[model samples]
Target: MNDAFGKRVRRLRLDRDWSQQELSLRSGISTPHISSIERGKRFPSLEYAKRIADALGVALVALCDDASELRSPKMRGSAEELPLYLQNFVLNEEATPYLEVAHQMSQLPKEDADLLSLVIGLLVKRRYETPVLTP
Candidate 1:
C-alpha cells in the first residue's frame, strides 16, 4: 500500500493498543505480512485492506484517508481555531487532561495564557513517549 495507507493502519493499530501479532490474529493476516504493510514494504489487496480495517474497528475509508490533508495551511495559525485544533490533537493522542487544559486556556485572557506553554510541554512529552510510526 501507499505510505499514507500504511501510516494510517499503524496509527489505528497503535490507538487500539494492538501489537502486530495481535492485529494479525484479529485480521487473519500473518504477523510478517502486517509488519511489511506497516513498513510500506508491501501492499495489501483491497480485500485484505478491508479485513484489516474491520479488525481495527475502523471504516475501510478511514484506513485510506490521508492524515496530512488535515494539516494543510488553512488549518493552521489562526488564534480563533488553534484551541479546536489542539483539542483534536490531544484527543487523538489520548491526552484528555491536556484537552481539558486547552479548553480552559481558550477562556483565559491572553496575558493569563502562559499556561498554554504547559499544554505544549505535555503534548511534546506525549509525542516522545509514543513516537509516530513512519513508513
Candidate 2:
C-alpha cells in the first residue's frame, strides 16, 4: 500500500519546507519512525497513515495518489477558475455528497454525462455572471 506513499509524503513535506521534527511534532510520531517511513523501510499502519495525512493537511487518499494533487488546477493557476465551492475540496468522507454525484455521473452514458456537465457548467457560469441586487 505504501509503495509510493513514502515518496508522496516526502514530496508533500518538502513542499511545505517542514523538517522531520516539525512533522513529528505535528503528527505525534517520532522522527526516527518518520525517517523509516520516508525511506520505505516500513509501511505505516492505517492509524498512523491517517495521522500523518492529517498532520500534512491533505486527505489520506492524497497520499495514495501518485501526485494527482500536484497537478490539480487548484495548485496550478488562479483559484477563481475553479468554482468557489470546489476550490478547497477535502478528499475525505465529508465530501461524500460530491463523491456520490461524481460516482453517479460515471455510471451515466457518455452523452448523458457530457450534457449534464455542460448544463451544470453553464448554470454556474450564468450565476457567477449575474449581479446580486441589494435590498
Candidate 3:
C-alpha cells in the first residue's frame, strides 16, 4: 500500500540533500527505521509520517497519493504552479480584502510591517475573523 509513498519519501529526502541519518536525527525517527520505511519494508503511522513530512519541508500528500494522507485546511502550496482549484481559491472574494490590506502595509517600517503581516496572517488562518483593516 505504501510502496509508492516510500519512493516519494526517498526522492524528497535526496532532493533536500538529506541522508537517512540526517533525516532521522532531524525528525527524531531512527536511521534504521527511516531506511526500512524508504525501502518499503515498513509503513509509518500517521504521526510519524507528519513529523517526517515536516522535517522534509513537504506536505504529507507529497509522500502518498492515497486516502490516508490527511488534508490540512490551512495548507498552502509553496510551489509556483498550483492546481486550478487552489488558483481559484486564491482569486476568490474572501482573499481580496486581505491582499489589499497587505499591499497597503508593505511600505511601513520593518517591525511595524511584520506585526501587521502577522495580524493579517492570523485573520486569514482563522478564516472567521471580521476583516477589519487595522494599521
Best by TM-score: 2
**Which candidate number would show the highest lDDT if scored against the true structure?**
2
- TM-score, structure 1 vs. true: 0.49
lDDT per model vs. reference = 0.71, 0.76, 0.72
Off by over 4 Å in 1: 67-135
TM-score of 3: 0.50
- Pairs of residues clashing in candidate 1: 1-43
lDDT of 1 by residue, 1-135 (tens): 477788888877776667898889889999999998998999899999989876665556667766532111111222345578665674576776765565456445556777677777899899889968879
Write down the RMSD of candidate 1 (Cα, Å): 17.0
Model 1 CA lDDT for position 12: 71
Score every model by TM-score: 0.49, 0.51, 0.50
Cα miss at 42, model 1 (Å)?
0.5
> How many clashes would you count in candidate 1?
1
Q: Against the hidden true structure, what lDDT does model 1 obtain?
A: 0.71
Which residue pairs show collisions in model 2? none
- Estimate, for each residue in 5-62, the C-alpha lDDT of model 3 and write its tens digit: 7787887777666789888987899999999999999999999998887666556665
